[model samples]
Target: MSDSKHSGKHDREMLLEMMHSTTKTSAEDLLISYKGILYPSVLCCLETFQALETFEAREDDILVVTYPKSGTNWLVQILYEMVSIVHNKEPLLDTTMIEFGSPEILARFKDRPSPRIISTHLQFKNIPKSMFEKKVKILLVLRNPKDTAISFYNFHNSLPPLPSYNSWNLFFKDFISGKVCYGPYFEFVAAWDNHFNDKTMMAITFEEMKVDFPTALKKISEFCQLPLNEEQIDLVARCTSFNSMKEQSENTHGKLGDSFFRKGEIGDWKNCFTEDQSKVVDEMFEKYLAGTKLGKMLNYAKYCKW
Candidate 1:
């Protein structure tokens, strides 16, 4: 082999060696908190989360995306029901959690038909620029971080056959450490909002969806360029209802059945947090989002029911 080729091979090996030697953060070790923001250390494995938008989407395709526990299931069911009513297709009923996100765009979803509807939790940095540049139809859902945490606490704590986190203190630590799916939640949201433009992205809040179901549904249908008459809206509503999601959580999602829908109600954070816990979250938020839009979005003026 040529000396230059040998040198190139050696450099590549060295880079891989350094990465292996590096003490990478584990999923359980990230502790990002502050102003309802999480900014834990991250590995770039998330960079592999992209697939072609047009490659996976047809001219008629659409997507619903969110951080975990941020009403992802609800949106999925809503969109599925909407599509079902509009096209009279069988409910895109698949019972695996893997189908929950943009995995549907990858080889894993090679079998899904055209005019596909997909989901994903990936931040823009993790995905291909090509996809976003395509300006595909996107429905991004944001939840109040405070409520997101409470929901996450309930969902993970209730898991069967997993290590039971018996104390709120320990779980909070894990949250601060960025040990959960969609960890550093604030960072993920900020990245999405900042990197992507508004036209292709229609960002909604969980609070809005809960407060105004019909309005949220109309906004989404319009974003996807599919208008539904009043009767059709009712059909979509019935299908994405909380009870409906809870009933088929395990059936429609990847795994972990009914557990997926434990208490979809908001402000449940009050059920567990003490005055002291509130202080902890406040401290972290102060450090992470002190003067940014996130800090402003956090709005100390905005009261959390906790």
Candidate 2:
């Protein structure tokens, strides 16, 4: 076998070993490593990032980037609708995420026509360099880390490959310490913050979208140059509401038996986090992001309600 194939085989073996072990402390230990980044599985992110290195980028391509469980699906669908409006065609683009590393999906992506939309959870450093060179428009979504942690905790418990925590306290401890998959949340957000000033990237908060849907949609449309009016923006907001998406998600992915939309609310961490856990997370947030834009926007000190 060629060296690349051999290395891919070895990576899969290592991933299986990690998944079989049950007593690991850090979630990183449960992941396979590639290019110095940890992934929940080797089949998806590791190989996707490897192949993505050479994937061509177009000037009009749109990439929706976000951390997991941070309203990625919601934003992607909205973007699709906006694209449909611009082209005056039915939205035929499939919104299934390509980060899972399916060859069929990659083939479709390569063969699909121009102005394609792709989604990823990769850090800014790990994305394809061609995207930067081509100057594609990137939409990034942010959520409070506390809520992100809580939602991700619940989401991972239902997945078999990831470590399952019996209690929120145990998960909270790991999450705060940057031990969970795609974690070190502060670092992830901070890394992306480097590109906040780049005109190619537009950053939006999930809370902002939730509170003022029409305004947020207009901002997104303006950023992408999709040119939607007030009525269209209002329609997109109503169509993409949590309740509407929840129903659609269940109907489409019910066979997967995973809950994709659970309690889509801000300040949800308040219900799961104890006073001690809240304080611990707040301290860690301040330690890692005391002076960053994300830190200021999160305002963990004022909203953690500890």
Candidate 3:
């Protein structure tokens, strides 16, 4: 085998060994290193990661990309509802999240019908290259890092496959240090900011969607060329409201339950972030995201600040 192939094989073996050896007492223990990025061992594996390099993205596919806890499922529900309205059919949520399954599970999506909605928490750099080459439309979601961190902390503790933190303090340290699965929140936002102006991508913030659902839904419709009449948009808005989704969580998420829905509030971080922790997040934003388009889009001063 070629040296590169041999190296890839060795890396997979080492990662599997590491994953099996750990008791998963901490975030570091439950994550596997793939191409220098950390991924939850339960959600990602080497085969799926490698297959993504050559994964064929349909031209009409809509890829919803977000960092964890950045309103991904919310957007997915809205998108599904929008398309269902356009087609005059009942909406069925497609949770064919690209990065969360094995190679075989990923392969199963190959034959899925047109206009597939693929979701991922993977950073922009890690997404399938064919997506860009095929010019697949991407809806990128951004959330204030403070809220993202808070929701992510709750998510980790609630999800059994993930390592649970004893307190927000420990999760906050891991979150800020880029030690959590999928790496640093700041870097993930910055990496996608590089492609924000790309013709195939549209970026939106979670706070915007929360404040004005109809306007946000309209923007998404225009970007994806999926027309939604005002009536239909209203229906989607009502169905996707955090409370509505939370009430239907067991039906929507099955055993995953309401943990996936959580609070979905814009500034719930205030309840969890200590004064010093908030300051650290502010400093990190300045250091990594300040003055960037994504930062401006996030409107940090309005949503993230006191």
Candidate 3 overall Cα lDDT vs. reference? 0.82
lDDT of model 2, residue 61: 89
**Who wins the TM-score comparison?**
3
How many clashing pairs per prediction, in order?
16, 0, 0
lDDT of 1 by residue, 1-306 (tens): 012333443322322223233443443443333234332222222212323332444445566677778887788778777777777787654422222222331444546665566666655554434446556777778776667777777765554322336677787777767656556766776676565566777777777778788888998888877679988887788778788777766444334455677877767776778888777766766666556554454444353534
Record all residue pairs in model 3 with backbone atoms less than 3 Å apart, i.e. clashing: none
> Candidate 1 regions off by >4 Å?
1-59, 95-105, 160-163, 250-255, 283-306
Tens-digit per-residue lDDT, 152-209, candidate 2: 8997786555767889888887777766666577778888876675589888888888
Write down the lDDT that model 2 would get: 0.72
Summarize candidate 3's per-residue lDDT along 66-166 as a digit string, tens digits: 99899988999888888888877777564556876567656757877767888898888888989988999999999999999999999888775578899
Candidate 1, lDDT over the whole model: 0.59
Cα error of candidate 2 at position 171, Å? 1.5
TM-scores for every predicted model: 0.72, 0.84, 0.89
**Runs with alpha carbons beyond 4 Å of true place in candidate 2:** 1-30, 42-45, 299-302
